[model samples]
Target: MNIVDFSKEEFQNQQIEASHLEEILKDFRRDGYVIFKDIFSKDYINELNADFIDKYGHLFSEEYKKNVFRVGHRRIQVSVELKKSFNTPYLYANPFILPVLEGIFNTEFIISDLTCVTSLPGAKYMPLHRDGAIFKGVALAPLLPAYAVGLLIPLIPFTKLNGPTRYWPGSHRSPLHSGAFEGNPNFIEPEIETGSCILMDYRIVHCGNPNQSDEKRPLLYCNYSLPWYFDSSNFRFDPHLIVDDNNYSDIPEEYKSLFQRRNMKLQ
Candidate 1:
């Protein structure tokens, strides 16, 4: 329920208060997730949203159905193109999030993927699930340190009418699967606006709410994980993060490590 407000003067000046940063780390560590409210500019978010719709919105059209994978009724997942409006340090290697990520991983993490999950009007609520499976054949999977985290940036406001994600706090540390937490009242579906995002441990128990509004709810989902961890389950059909030549060249030298796992065109 605690949301980090990044619009404060200190945070705006590229300096996050130590206490706020500590709270972010502690909240994520204890709750397995945290919400960042209005951390980005509305104009910037609108640009990305417009570009995303211009490039990939056709996937939702009845006439153009290729490369679309349905995750639930009326909800589909597709790949995101990292070019033009989306090829920036703020979107990928954000300074504001890096510190918290470092605190969680305690190591250099890679930007594993960039995908979009769009829930169309009348979409049904998705079944409770974890984004990835725990380490198979390992008895201590639940005991391991955080390996991967998911960051969800919504193109539009995440309102109660348009599906927002329902998260069961602290369920990531349990050895049991997400189904064990089903129907629990101790869950939260926070309605956040544009310029905000949610970061969650990939092992956490959660699901998307039903979309009751007429608009489409699109979430720009990016996955960040430790250098050695590869998510082989999610992108089985579509390609993972793809960085075009232009975008790749634009990436800062220091942040290139984050895109080491990205698929790129020949130079």
Candidate 2:
């Protein structure tokens, strides 16, 4: 299968027509993923990178005390104190994705998880896997609608050396196939730039490749799904809190609605 690409302009009309929506949905259903190129500005990406480095780079430094959280030794998940000031939700909430999400989950969906993954040099290969498994068996596994999707924004220019994500085409509809994690014969590694973003069907079989380069590979991740599913990777807040809790009141009002899907609109 060929890697499909779209532009931000094509989806800039505020309202996406049904025909356009069908075209995108068809490609996603067939290929398991889509790339929107040059959707973000370089300056914006640079700012995000700088901010990430400022916040997480230190944790990786000599002063490392306890802030760094690692999925692996090299895949650092930087937990920002102020989650709201992070990247804007507009990119993830773009017209191209919102329409398809609405079609899958109908009228409502929410962002269950949000975090950034920076794979440093020498990051090992990740075992291919699904983000969530609602159905493990049965004939319906391949035909059931998608319950979750992920939006990946590259914070730096991606190259094979820095380890771009490796994805299997059309695997979103199937059960976990054996030997896929060890390096499947059918996989595509699309080379996208910093301004681009990948919309991935959460059920799709994918894995992170080893970083051959010396630079850090940073990518912001956000997962959206039907309200019923609680993402295992999600950071659930504590209900019992003291007055000295993390100060998040300073975050933008729009950022908070993501937790409840209260502020999202399909149209």
Q: Which numbered prediction scores highest in TM-score against the true structure? A: 1
Worst 10 residues of 1 by lDDT: 258-267
Stretches of model 2 off by over 4 angstroms after superposition: 1-17, 62-67, 80-87, 178-183, 233-257, 261-267
Which regions in candidate 1 have their CA more than 4 angstroms from the true location? 136-139, 264-267
What's the TM for model 2?
0.80
TM-score, every prediction: 0.94, 0.80
Tell me model 2's lDDT, rounded to 2 decimals.
0.68
- Using lDDT as the measure, the top candidate is 1
lDDT of 2 at 198: 87
Clash counts for the predictions, in order: 0, 0
